[model samples]
Target: MKTSSFYVAFDEAHKPRGKIAGNYSHLKEFLDSQGFICQPYMEFPITRQNLSPYDILVIPCPDFAKFSTNEIDAIAQWVKEDGGGLLALSHAGGDKGRRSNLSELVEKFGLSFENDQVLDYSKNFGLENLPEVVNFSPPHPITEGITSLCFRAGCSLSTVGLNVVPVAISNEESDPFSTPLIVTAEVQEGRVVAIGSYEMFRNEIPGGFEQPGHQEFCSNIFQWLKTEYREKVKTGEIKPKVTIQEPTQNYDANGITANVGSQPSFISAKLNLSSHIVISDKSDLANLFHGLLDEVTVLKDQIKTVIETIVSSEEQILETQKATESAEAATPLELPPNIEPLPVPEPERLTEMPEKPKSMKDTKKKTDTHLPKTKTHQPQPIPDPLPMTKEEIEVELETLKNKLNSIENLKDLVESKYKNKSYTKAQYEKQIERLSNDLNRSLNRIKELEMQYTKGKK
Candidate 1:
């Protein structure tokens, strides 16, 4: 019956700079009011081992640094096996500068976040920046009692799995025609929710949570998460006891019949002998019936006593066998006559082994008269090899190729940034110069390794 606990991660390399900027204190306080344990989860790169302690994990508005392959796999596995809840919040331009690579994590649960932003001028709040979301669809457990919400610079969600539910959508003014704002889904034994905006739960934003139905929407999300973990607890609790019905018997003047319950025991076994019985004489029928009833009662008690005795004897025999085994193991084995024990030599005798006739030591001593004495092996410092083997050279060549590819990607990103006016011309030139130097050095190394590999092959 304890409250649910949440671990909010803020250790992302590109998380918003200041507390007021990306902090979720408003959400934390609200969760606290609902009797939840909220704690900051700074120690991460979220793995399965560390995730077991929390009922729910919240990564609110992460950065462009994508989670490692192992981390993504761990989070997915933890959610499925531990029945953990996950909440991923992404901002506009997902995977772009200062934004998150949340798609890697969300895709595991069959959810996706679009790179473009959703702008609704007509249905938005007072400012165009705050896109109003009045289209709450499906009305799931997480979106219960939620009709309207205002999102600040949020993106859109897409469903890739049958289990995925579109919780909300943008209006007609959205950049892309009426897209999904929030997506929720179930994966294995767990639940997941992905929202396009993190700012909806932030405090002190102009008409953020102050807007109508914002707080209710936030409450419903956490409430559903908490209820999920609680339901799992209830399902795994001790099962109810089964009831056994009494045996029923029907009697006629001509014959008697007995009906046994489903779980047939000793009584049923006895009844198997005769389903029907007949009596010929009416004069002694009453006496015979009384005698038969008494006999059955005695027989039942005898059978119960016999079963208990057999069970007790079996347990006693098992314990006795275990004790005998332990005793035998503790005792040492007797030595065989064929295997003679070696005699313990005197202390002085133990210092030196007896020499055999014409031993290798005598031969070596004679040979040493003509041979030069050997010098001590003074270990020389071995230099590190450069692509010593063909395999090594091939691996280095592949690594260089990957580095070159990365450099090209960086160049493309730089161009994109310049076009977006995020970098000045001078800044762009300096970055390009550094990247060019790295690319040139990598290309040269790749050529050298290739030449060495060819020579080795020849």
Candidate 2:
């Protein structure tokens, strides 16, 4: 098999529902056959320094979590400056369905995922979730030679900037006919592709890798996504926007530059505490300390969960990866006939997502609080509910608590930025209001979870 320098990283830090080797081994194998190196990105905080080595980053459906503001900025900046390729994938019903905020990150590239699944009853592959789509728009490299392909249980997408283009659409027979299903962008020196369905790349599943034209389409996507800019960075042609190399100070508890430095003594170090941030009084400083402590707690829980997931799944993950080595020998799992009744996706609970704020320093808006709410929840599909274990319930509760902590930390960080006048009053108000809504939603969701747990116990 031929190989190339194009490196692809599948993010594993944010609790993605699909593991590369476990669920996307087919994708890994395909990319490998094309000479691309694939690896799981498990680095925490997602700093530019950590991402500098790769040409492409793929986020495969983060579940029940939100990427921190710092991490999002890092990713966005990496793609725009370092010639990185970002391929953020989501499932049916989009971010709202998964209880995640991937659209938040991809919006930086002028594309957003919709909260509706594409369904075609008349034109499907044995089932409605497996929508047979053949719509290709004005010729684009990514859609080259791709006539028909399986959309496979995925949501839709919308584009904004002129640089961003939609290459594929839903058939007139499907729900929301002709809407964008795959959006791409030429952002600065980098490239971005956002697709709603990650399932199409799975191994031995209906509407998956075996879907006739899928392999050809996959080749086109990778060939287009493998940006030449990564090679530029290697030859010292450009510098990354993130400046972590010089004097290192990873994100402080506030996810911003702080007084903390790696230097041994304060005399030679660049002191940021007294210079940049205006701590009105001792009380404010105390509050900062308290916020740091809370942040520490959140980080601890995050690390614990990541470690536990790795330890628990280590063996299985390795076996799955090893299984890929002998893939040619293994007979593909026979896809079952579509006799099983179509599983109804949970009714989508829609949230009014505010239009993307034009600028980070955007002026005060006329209305901030009463804005529409948006959500994407992968319903407990129409299939029979599986029995839940006590451990599962406990883990869920912990996850909810951790999310609450993260929101609080984000609130504090934004407020601190406001205090320093880094954000306009309007920007601050808008962020705080959104964070407030997130807090309430997380609280309500916790109650709902507890009730379900109790009902199960009974």
Best by TM-score: 2
Segments of candidate 1 deviating more than 4 angstroms: 1-22, 97-99, 227-230, 234-458
lDDT of each: 0.62, 0.72
Give the per-residue Cα lDDT of candidate 1 at 355.
75
Query: How many angstroms is residue 121 displaced in model 1 relative to the true structure, after the best TM-score fit?
Result: 1.8
Question: What is the overall TM-score of model 2 with all chains considered together?
Answer: 0.53
User: Best by lDDT, which number?
Assistant: 2
Worst 10 residues of 1 by lDDT: 238-247
Q: Compared to the true structure, candidate 1 yields what TM-score?
A: 0.49
**Per-residue CA lDDT of candidate 2, range 25-83, in tens?**
67777888998877767667788888876788889878656788899989988888777
- For each candidate, how many residue pairs have backbone atoms clashing (under 3 Å)? 1, 11
Q: What is the TM-score of each candidate against the true structure?
A: 0.49, 0.53
